[model samples]
Target: MQSRREFLQSCLATPLLLNNFRYSDEKIITVLGEVTTSQLGPALIHEHILVDFIGADKISSNRWEHSQVISKVLPYLTEIKNRGIKTLVECTPAYIGRDVLLLEKISKQSGIHIITNTGYYGASDNKYLPPWAFRETPVQLARRWISESVNGIEGSKIRPGFIKIGVNPGPLSPMHQKLVKAAALTHLETGLTICSHTGPAIPAFEQIELLEKEGVHPGAFVWVHANSSDTNNFIKAAKMGAWISLDGISDDSLLKNAEIIHLLKTENLLNKVLISHDAGWYKPGEENGGEFRGFTTISDKLLPLLKTKGFTNADLDQLMLKNPVQMLSVRVRKT
Candidate 1:
């Protein structure tokens, strides 16, 4: 009998299995409108424009002005645009300061394709979840998300490009499971990719398993914040056709992130990986948005480190360009 690693390798080698993870002709939804994958160019799969840590009941768009946020955050978007980043996925979910109008304004001013999401964030002990999230069934929650995808978010014509949900970092709690199921239902109807803010392998795999049980293929899910999980777990999850998002790239983690990417390349799993700084945002209620981090580390720091580690231009493209386009392109990936 084949060992687990051997079985995974064989499965990845299968043409049909691999094709399921490739980019399709489908267009990705942007804050402005739909764009082809080729138009996506070099992309950051995970990042934020604004985030409010206040509990859901208290969070409101009234706390921050769109003009002030655009003034504070547009320079960072321009910085990445200068570095050849054409697209940015704003992963901040609803009830935590996800203003689609704000994202649309930033995208228009900066000339960068910004993609926003639809869903609830259940991480941080469910503090970001609205009160109704606890009372609503998965189907009910999914209807809300689907409505946004079809009719546009918050009464505007700006539709979500993906489904962004969050779960705590342990085994799936009942509430978190409901969030995952709702995401699944939304994806089935809207074909939006699910980007869950999951750290560590336990919850990541649990979410993946839950997605599979819902008849959503693993390719439909992105294991966000996957840098927190073991490298071995990355191999396992990548073999299952999930996108491994090592999105917390920073100056402090240059070497470690480079090594991890190198290992994934060696395992022939680099195509399944997504990289970003997980940086940015104008924090609500903080003076001057508090110490905002620019989204330049991957372009300025990590890419240089990766090149020193013998990464080719094509390898870099696979991580920054191809992988993201394939992973984020709109498709209903069902098993």
Candidate 2:
């Protein structure tokens, strides 16, 4: 049997064999399962279906009945679906409330495509990482993640759609470098895109350099939380072929987010930009699943604001539809 990577490359390389070149040819992995890129309309690149940061060490204690969590979150997801967001990437990473089963359930119940990720996110405080990560080499870490992408996460048949990782705010720590390098290695093996929780530009550049050193193109990387960084650095990275994800959109920050979007538009780099709320999730062990920020915020708020600021429907399509397909699609490495 041809591997999924090989199958995608074969199909993508021969567009006439299918039909159109861009949308119809590419496939993306979602939480419920896989779907063609054409099926992912008006997508959100970053959102969590559930989160358990407080119980990182004891996930069991944080665990709630799946139905209860689903009941709390499904309505919000349904509202997002009603607003026309077809796909959503669940950014929750392992050891940090990354629950694939719950995500799958949410996707099914809400009638949305949810793409879950594979990779550890121990960047902020390093507490989310398992003890073994501190001792493992980069190759070992890569191999484990590669297995998840090739096989399935935690032995479930649901494979991860992308590589999710993060580093500390400033200099890349030893562990951070290892995790980024591992994401690079896994990308090489699986052709999956790497979405790292990066910020403050310099560290994002460091990550791009590390991936480049490993022969992974910057196009395969996503600089998450990019709106928090300097505009100059954001443009620089986008020009370098990295996906600059301005994922901090909200009601209060629409104008602020619009400023960055306008900058990207002026630079003619809108093709490289992605936007989302970084919002909405059921917090385990919280009343009413803790403040569930509906995932439809971007669609409801910022998008119209962008239109008023001179983003044509075509530009909005690129940001909401086409850019995501390109960013999420598995890139065939040049041979």
Candidate 3:
């Protein structure tokens, strides 16, 4: 229930650590339904723990599915935990197979701080559906998102810890803008953070501005999919206040890999950046992004690259953990 500033101030009370700020036991705080101790471990800001499709008459993946899913996702999430990853923000929302119960189950099974999302994605994602397909007044939609994010989704125990918005691959549509405003209002009301599904395009920054129209704070919003964006654009976004999620680390493109590495070194925006694979994209009966690709990127690639680049232990911790914890505190909750 603490505000964003309160969380950051509390975290800063602890002395800075060699690798990052060491969480002091005395300053730990509980959030949403989970407890965040000052133990200070690695955190992934953008990734999907569960992703299934919903429909007009379909219930989609729900808690009942948790029993089945845990057996599958537990192994992958466990590997992340094994790599010393302690916390992860699940950016999936209502439309993108955002199942709170399933995420909670994953957290319980994996013993990681799994932060789930609330609110709907961009209209392009669900504009095809009727009823919801028809556009409603901003207030009406905002009310629904606020309720879903704060309260449970349809009386379920899965409350969203953040509000999520998105920008299509091109310019922001009027629908995306409306959704952004609603997302921002939902966050202002609930103190939850806002995460977005921005592509490797320019709209992420534009989306941030639209959210700004509602006075959304930049620190609390994380613009995703920047790992493939233009180099300077990535830095520009970091300068704007929202955390830049370099989450597409799995694409296996050496040019992108090298570009990201260079940006990490030159920008020195480690505290405002994040890393994730955005994996586990299980579309109803489809496995587009799921796999047992060991934590090669986090465990082997990035760290080794950092060491080779002469990033001190402190620098590694900042890029790996501290920066994320700091950004997590910037946005108030959407739920």
Candidate 4:
């Protein structure tokens, strides 16, 4: 029987598999352009530069000015950059203030490689979804997203690094299921990993199952907000080849997050784990874009806690560096 590490190594090393699945290139799409995984250093797999909660109907780029948002948000990116963070996966999707041009400018100014996405967020009771999301078939939606992958989003010539979707905390709703299927279809065509804002195990497993039913591998699905699920589920999902994203790290959740990491390490599933602050954003309509959270908790708080828990520098690198390259690298993982 093959061990998990051996299985992962085989998958990553097989030249024929890489050619077939388009993994030989091993590139990560950023707002600026494609970059080799080696170019992506210690990364925060999930973070936001700006997010506007205004519904899809009313959300527009005009809601916030670029200069004002940059002035307010750049310092946070600079903070993380100074802390040795190289990449920030901006999780704010379209219709919710995902300005690729703005991300380009920020990446250039902050010297942090920024990645944007191309998917409709169906969470928040579907408030962020546009009307077409409800009316279009999954295939149609997939076509639109695949076009963005090939052609670039909103004519910006900036492609997405992954597929971002959302579902309510419960079992997948019919609409959310459509979003999952669309994400699966998009992944099959474009090789973009699916990062769903799922909070609980029920929806997380449902999304994984749905992706598998579409012939997409669980490796291509990232269970975002996996910290909200039970630890046993993290073990189960990681064993099943899903990336467990415990992205809600904060000062208050430090001990809890550290305990979870320790448990996963004991289970020998650390290779499947991803950690981040899920922090940031200059909120639109609020005074100065609201109380913006800096992206430094993992650097200043979580790493030190993990060390106290007997985590070595290698374990820390696995969580912050190696796992991110494996997770975020563009590959068509098929079952």
Superposition-based RMSD of candidate 3 using all C-alpha atoms, in angstroms: 8.3
What is the per-residue lDDT of model 1 for residues 13-51, given as tens digits with 9 covering 90 to 100? 322112223556889999999998768878988898898
lDDT (tens digit, per residue) of candidate 4 on 123-210: 8899999899999999999999999999999987999999999999998999999999999999999989999999999999999999
**lDDT, candidate 4, residue 285?**
95
What are the TM-scores, per candidate, against the unseen true structure? 0.92, 0.91, 0.81, 0.92
lDDT of 3 by residue, 36-131 (tens): 545536777677666554542354554235566677677777777766778777777665566666676677767888776666666355542325
- Candidate 2 residues 1-335, lDDT tens each? 88755644443332111123267576798876778877877789998877787645777533678878888888787787766678888999998888787777777778888998988886767888888788999899999998988788887888999999988889898889999988988999988999999878788999999899988999999999988798999889999899999998888888889989998999999999999999887887788778888876677667666766877667777888888889898764421
lDDT value, residue 163 of candidate 3:
69
Q: What is the lDDT of residue 161 in candidate 3?
A: 61
Show how many residue pairs clash in every candidate, following the order shown.
0, 0, 6, 0
Task: Output the TM-score of candidate 1.
Answer: 0.92
**What are the per-model C-alpha RMSD values against the true structure?**
8.3, 9.1, 8.3, 7.8
lDDT of 1: 0.88
Q: Could you say which candidate leads in lDDT?
A: 4
Q: Score candidate 3 by TM-score against the native.
A: 0.81
lDDT of 2 at 210: 89
Model 2, residue 299: C-alpha shift (Å): 1.2
Clashing pairs in 1: none
lDDT of model number 3: 0.64
